[model samples]
Target: NSHRVTYIHNLFQNGAATIAGVSEMFKERKRRGEIPADEEITFIMVTGDGGADIGMGPIVGTANRNDNVILLEYDNEGYMNTGNQLSYATPLGHATSTSHVGPAQVGKQFQHKDTIQIMAGTHIPYLFTGTESQPQDLIKKAAKAQWYAKNYGTVYGKILAACPLNWKNETRDGRNVVDAAVNCNFFPLYEIEQGITTLTYDPEAKGKKVELEDWLKMMGKTKHLLKPENKEIVEAARKEVERRFKRLKAMSEHPDL
Candidate 1:
């Protein structure tokens, strides 16, 4: 049988209530014989800064309840649609409208939030990271996300997108910028299935891994981090990437994670 899909956009904070209400309404209609019981419907919500920032609490609650929904996050590292203000997803030492770099402030002072890992804590049935740089991998993960959301429970997926305007990179270089991120293991390709972590692509294994600086140097927002005075922040950012990848490696080896 084929499943019917319904797409909707809501404010990030309202996503959980909207999905819970809509999905239950569909099911209730089926129960009343208004729709066939076997007829399936999947609800998908697309959000950016809305979900990762102010809307996070409700998102987490929905995941905790195992709501039947697919939440896809388009992470451009800032609130791109709203003037490129810094969001929780923005990386440390990255300059945004709010996280300005000057003699007083050196970009954002804190690290970016690991929203994917945070969602994993909700014990959702499926969650993965994807980007346009790896279309095939993204497509596969998306299909899997839909399947899990339809037959199992909630699914979350993150796409590390590029904002050429905000990042101050050439529009034509957007794809390559994202590719560099994946290559440097700054944004690794991976998925967590029912708490079992798996690395979809390993840059180091494929000899494609580049230093964190390689990726940082590609974006204007982060180029300042390369300055001698900003070396400490750059090092911290590098260490954070290594720590996360190492933990992910350990988890992939130990299925109990």
Candidate 2:
């Protein structure tokens, strides 16, 4: 059997796809033998953090959107499509069009939302993180999303991308910034399958685990935090990265999770 692709606009302007609606469509497809009983159908939704996070309702809807639909997040940290405004995914201490840094104001005051944990909390079958830094790893996750290798539920993946124009970095160095983000543990690579968590990329290799400053200095968006007087904010960002990675490490060790 072969699969088909379709696009639905007005997802927000008209109405977000609900559980009942998606369930019925897949049911009908299978009933018509359009989807083979032995072949798992792959339903994919690629969106941005700012738009997808407007309400948890969509996230909840996605969790129950049959045992298919994989949501891929092209996480650009800020709303790249909207003049680099701050989104929930933008890290703290990073300056954006919406979250500015000045003598009195200090970039974004909040840490990026724990999106992965939120998706994980839904008890979805699979959750993955990939970055432009590692093209091979990203490709593997994309393929895995279609296969449902171990479980039969949602397979979500987040791709950490560096915006050269927004980040005030050279276009040629965009990939390097992605690599730094991974090595700094700011956006580590991993996956959760059937409640079993695994760390796909280990940053423990020699010179692999670098200080968060190394990552921060790569992009001008976060250059404000590197200021001598802004040491406290810099430390806070570093601590957050460390804390997040620690939790991920624990999750990776517990395969029975």
Candidate lDDT values, in order: 0.87, 0.78
TM-score of each: 0.94, 0.87
Residue-level lDDT of model 1, residues 104-155, one tens digit each, is 9999989888888999988899999999999999999988999999888999
Q: Which clashing pairs does model 1 show?
A: none
lDDT of 2 by residue, 75-109 (tens): 88877877998988989889999888887688898
State the displacement of the C-alpha of residue 105, model 2, in Å, after optimal TM-score superposition.
1.4
lDDT of 1 at 10: 65
Off by over 4 Å in 2: 1-5, 11-23, 32-41, 149-151
lDDT of 1: 0.87
Give, for candidate 2, the lowest lDDT window spanning 10 residues: 11-20
**Number of the predicted model whose TM-score against the real structure is largest:** 1
